[model samples]
Target: MSVDVFTFGLNHTSAPLSVRERVAVPGELLRPALDALRSTWGAAVREAAILSTCNRTEIYCAAEPQVVDQLPAWMAQFHKLESTSLQPHVYRYQQNDAVRHAFRVASGLDSMVLGEPQILGQMKDAVRAANEAGALGTLLHQLFQRTFSVAKEVRSQTAIGANSVSMAAAAVRLAERVFGDLDQANVLFIGAGEMIELCATHFAAAHPRGMMVANRTVERADLLASRFSATTMKLSQLPERLADFDVVVSCTASSLPILGLGMVERASRLRRHRPMVMVDLAVPRDIETEVGRLDDVYLYTVDDLGRMVQTGTDARRAAVVQAEAIIETRVQNFMHWMQKREIVPAIMEMHEASEKVQQAELERARRMLARGVAPEQVLEQLAYGLTQKFMHGPLSALNRSEAGEREQLLELMPQLLPRTERRR
Candidate 1:
């Protein structure tokens, strides 16, 4: 059976955030998820890796024939969802298409936000986790290695990432929409993670009247705060001070909602229902959904940020043509390698058959020489025997063909035969 490369998943285009979050595997769950994927299929799947981001949940694998089709079912089983429900959202790519999809994803061509650089980092992290889980084999290893190189090539060769609008930048734009002038707004960043640090930089550039970072760990919050000449607040102080900030941008690793409706309601009451903007960059969401429903609160989730970052897609669209030309060439190169690999077993079988014929002819020639037969005669016999043995299979196949096949084989026979037979 052919063990082909495949990529299967649902992304922002294929599914909404509700479906995405249901299947999305967090960083901590990646290793176990990979292990489960391999153990679930055993020998049928030779290699596997899972890339689960806020916008996508993809499974890349090299597997035997018929195994590629099992992924949707496998995913449904893994996520404890109905197979039918997942099928509409799932997409599958095989062989060249698989490689192309991976290259596109790493290059940020397939991202919800066109040309965002964060996906490359996320893909690298997924690869590392897959490597640690022992899921990377020769096919997957070469795939990602080439994927990284292709991403680099696309980034360097084209203006794909120019004028990139990141999620943090989007959060700042949303804040400005709510308050009109960010300079007059007091911005508070909840959680000093990478997204928050980025948001802090964007907001600080506006030179907000006040900037503070609140985190469960004050050390991390303080570290990020120092860069912007901002102050750090404890998570415990959120309820008391959440009312003071006009803009709140949050991203955290917390599993549960950190900012609930009750706390925000109290905060709104204290502020006399003054308009406040809240941006949640978390997957599970750092703030509650109910918070967005409040009269004076404006809440934006990661999905909201995705739409915000799509402003200059027209410019990025031109770069895509150039990027695709590079990716198509690389895809052909990768597919050629896979094609060579597919014929390996046939090549090995031919080698073994030819070796056996050679061994038999060599033994007979040796015996003929030992029996005082002339060297010239024995050499002639060995040559004829080896030639006949080599031609036997092709000759038989050609002779057995009925009509159309026979004509094709007759035409191909000269090409397949040695120069000596071709002359005959």
Candidate 2:
């Protein structure tokens, strides 16, 4: 059987964050998961990549059809979850559907925040990880290449990315709701990634009382802090100093929770039960879920931030029809390429046979010329011989074919033969 491209997983829309957090493969674990997936169903799965982000964790692969039956169980087992629990939220796409899904996702069409550009970078990261793990094969590599091209085309040609509220802006909005006036509140960002930088930019406009950036690497944190004239701290200081900030924003690539329930509880205690807003933008989540239950702590995950990012969606929606039209045309073009690629073997065979016929006729003409046949007659006979060779099999098949088969061949003749005025 032919290998087919497939994508399977759950996203923010397909499942709740609680479920997504459980199945999400963090950045560090993507390669391991991809390696396992490639060998999970023996030789069925040929190439694979897993795109895991705050709002989604999806697996894209080239595999045999039967591998579909085994994927859900394998994924659940890899995550150490019950297959039954994971099954209900899973969505699977095959071949063209899978190609379309990858393109839409890279274009930010399927994201929690429509037209969010972060996903494109995240996808590139996944592709890099998969390449590093040697999990990329011809089919998947081509699919992703085209997927990226289509995404670029969509973004460059359409208004899908215009007038959009990003998650960073949303984080700032959410903080405003709790603090009322951010100028008086001290804000601490827990990571120095692009999201944190964007958040810092929005938050700085409020002229907060103080701003601090905490990151695993002090150099990176300092670099970011320098841009905003904020202070920097090591990641380890969060436990003891978390109580000082009134608003906290975190977006990290950490595989495990950095801030646990006890840590947040201590912070709440130190704050004398004063209200504190926490935004956790990590996929596996930098903050513990139990922190959300703390009375004084307003813990918001990426999903919560998603709700606040819907400000200018009407504009994006207006462009959706146009975006879809562009995507559909690209999808058709890609599928047409794939269809032609599938027939390459037959095309090569036809060329090889035609070349052999030409050579054989030339050799016969050489033999006739050596026997002293006239040059004009030899050329004529060679032409006749080559034509006979090309048409003999088709004519013989037509003559021997049954009535129904002959009718089919007759109908196909126009396509198979070159049209001349006489034949027409």
- Residues 1-424 of candidate 1 have per-residue lDDT tens digits of 5688999999989998778777878888888888888898788889988998878999999987688777888888887999778888889998899999999999999998888888898899899999998999989999999999999999999989989989988888888887878788898988877678888888888988999999999899889999999998899999899999999988887767899999999999999999999998887678989998999999988888898788777978999999999999999999998888778988999899889999999999999999999999999999999988888888789788899999999898778776743563
Where does candidate 2 stray beyond 4 Å? 41-43, 420-424
- Candidate 2: C-alpha RMSD after superposition: 2.6
Q: What lDDT score belongs to each candidate, Candidate 1 first?
A: 0.89, 0.88
TM-scores, in order shown?
0.90, 0.92
Best by TM-score: 2
